[model samples]
Target: MKRKKNNKTGLYMLGGVVFIYIGLFLFDSAKALQAVEEAFGVLKMVLPIVLVVFFLMGLVNITIDKEKISRHFGKESGMKGWFYAISAGVLSHGPAYVWYPFLQNLREHGAKDSLVFAFLYARSIKIPWIPLMVSYFGLSFTVFFSLYIVVASLLQGLVVEAFSKAKR
Candidate 1:
């Protein structure tokens, strides 16, 4: 039964390619190829960085106990969760994508999904990026956005928690 399903899936994939080719062939073939090449170029550039990051992440996973990390940052006492989230946001480097493995590790170690979401939200509201955002949007909008993001992060955690409880 599974084999029959897999064959059907393969046939569907081939049909999709034929459909796409028909569309592109009837449309602008040159533009489609150019877009494909540009996408491949982007993938080529990112692959090496991702490989190195993955390697480093493997080392961290092997060396550290993520449960300890969750214990260190997951505490909500004395506004510590916010501070931890903010500090982790600032001190962490590289693309936001890089943090997923670590965040997943934290989650496996009993960190709430909302806390992970908050960390990422806080990271996006980077302190250094504030000047750039202010320069582009001006102080009023920038301040509002910043405050909005912080409140939203905590609220996000709470909402997700509520949803999880509801699911049970």
Candidate 2:
């Protein structure tokens, strides 16, 4: 029932060129292209990872226990509810866009959109990424950022619930 999005890489590239032209008025053309190409290269690698992760997640989702998840989530206990929100990230990996289809399916299956959003924010704060971040930002920065991610993700879920109910 949903409309599919067309591939818009050409449009994005064209827009990038326009932005590059304007950027050159204040910056260097060669440097800008190098920066753009570097960014594009990152995207090129990221897209495949995203696709693979999404596919795996989609398959796992179809094969898993929906009833148990539904039961646990429908409860009123605060800690349990919060735990469900946090634990959602246990399976999610890769970039944000990769998780959209899964989240959309969750929403269709009675998942609160806020929880789905929070789950996503939590995914970015993964413990696996900590070692790399620790080497770059030191322990304190990594710790604080991790805490911020958890809190923000929880708050995002809450806000999403508030907005959805309000809209209703």
Per-model CA lDDT versus the true structure: 0.69, 0.69
Error of 2 at 67 (Å): 4.0
Candidate 1 residue-wise lDDT, 16-122, digit = tens: 97788668867998887877788689778767767776876677578766556566654432267656765676555557876776666566655667677777877
lDDT of 2 by residue, 1-168 (tens): 234566796699889987866787467777777777887888887787777767756774786555654555533325675677677664455667766766666545445556666677788776777799999999999989888888988888788767767877
Residue 9, candidate 1: Cα error in Å is 13
TM-score of each: 0.64, 0.59
